[model samples]
Each structure stands twice: as structure tokens, then as C-alpha cells.
Target: MSLDSATVRRIAALARIRVEDDELPRVQAEINGILGWIEQLQAVNTEGVEPMSGGSPVGQAQARLRPDAVTDGDRAEQVLANAPDRMGAWFGVPKVVE
Candidate 1:
């Protein structure tokens, strides 16, 4: 498909790109070049090629995560001790609403 001056102007307007009167031909030429390249790419024959995620044929298996183990980190008391204001085991803050 060939990109014409009108199509280029419409695309520029839609993309919010302001092309001056003199620059319209330049923009149109650039769009035609890009579309020409795309037309060349469309002629390639890829009959039985499976689409791979990372562009590589050898798909690497995802690494397994370690099973969740019940271990106590136990830093609650230490964190609470450094608070500016604490009531028993909870943080104390000034009332935000009247």
C-alpha cells in the first residue's frame, strides 16, 4: 500500500504533529519510505515457524519459587519501641478528623 500526501496529512493531524506547508512533502516521502519497507516485509514466507516469546527458539523453563515455610521474623516489638508515640502495643497518632 502506497502512502499519499493526503494520508500523511491526516496521520500528522491525528498524531497532533504540525506539518508546515513546505514540510508536507517531506512527511509524505518519509511515510512512503516506511510503508515501502513494510510491503517488503509482508513478502517473506514463514510457513511453519512457531512464535517464540523472547525471539529465541530454545525456550527456557521458568525457575520455581521456594515453598512458603513458617518462620518467625519476630521484629514487631523492636519496630514498636522506636515509635514517636505508642499506646501498649499500638502506634498513637493525633485525631485527623473533628
Candidate 2:
């Protein structure tokens, strides 16, 4: 599949890219080449291929299971003592932006 100049400009606009008039041909050709590669990839036959999780072969997986626990260690008061500028219950910092 080939991409035209208008489609390339639309794509550039949708992607928030600035494409000048003279660069449209190069951009359109590159997009057409990418589409052609995708078309070529679609022609490949994968009849009996099993989908693996995240491209890792299922046979080589060794995941360590851990317990899911939600417990606050009650260290909030202890940690807030080290703040140089502490408001009532929050840490204050100098403004870094104009």
C-alpha cells in the first residue's frame, strides 16, 4: 500500500508533527515503505503457532510468587520528624519554577 501526500499531511497533523511542503514526498515514501512491510508481514502463514506471554517462551518461565500484604508500619510520625520545612502535616519546599 502507498500513502499519498494528503494522507501523509493528515497523519503528520494528527501526530502533532510539522511537515513542510518540500518534505512531503520523503515522508509519504517512508510511510508507504512501512505499510508495504506490514503488508508483507501479513502474508506470512502461522497456522499452528501458540501465542506466548510477552514473547517469552512458556517452557523457560520461573516466576517467584510472593504474598500480597497491605500493612502500614506506623512510621509516618517518625519520618515527618526529619523534614526541614514541615507544615501542619505536610512537607514544604522552595518553589523551583517561575
State which candidate has the highest TM-score.
2
Q: Give the per-residue lDDT of model 1 (tens digit) for 1-98.
A: 77778888899999999999899988888888888899898888878877677655657675589889987868779989899999887899999999
The CA lDDT of each predicted structure is 0.85, 0.87
Task: List the candidates' TM-scores in order.
Answer: 0.58, 0.61
Report, for all candidates in order, the number of backbone clashes: 0, 0
Off by over 4 Å in 1: 58-60, 63-98
Query: What stretches of model 2 exceed 4 Å from their correct place?
Result: 57-62, 70-98
Give lDDT tens digits, candidate 2, residues 1-98: 77779889999999999999989999999999999999999999978886687678677756777778888868767888999998877788899999
Weakest ten-residue segment in model 1 by summed lDDT: 54-63
Candidate 1 lDDT for residue 35: 87
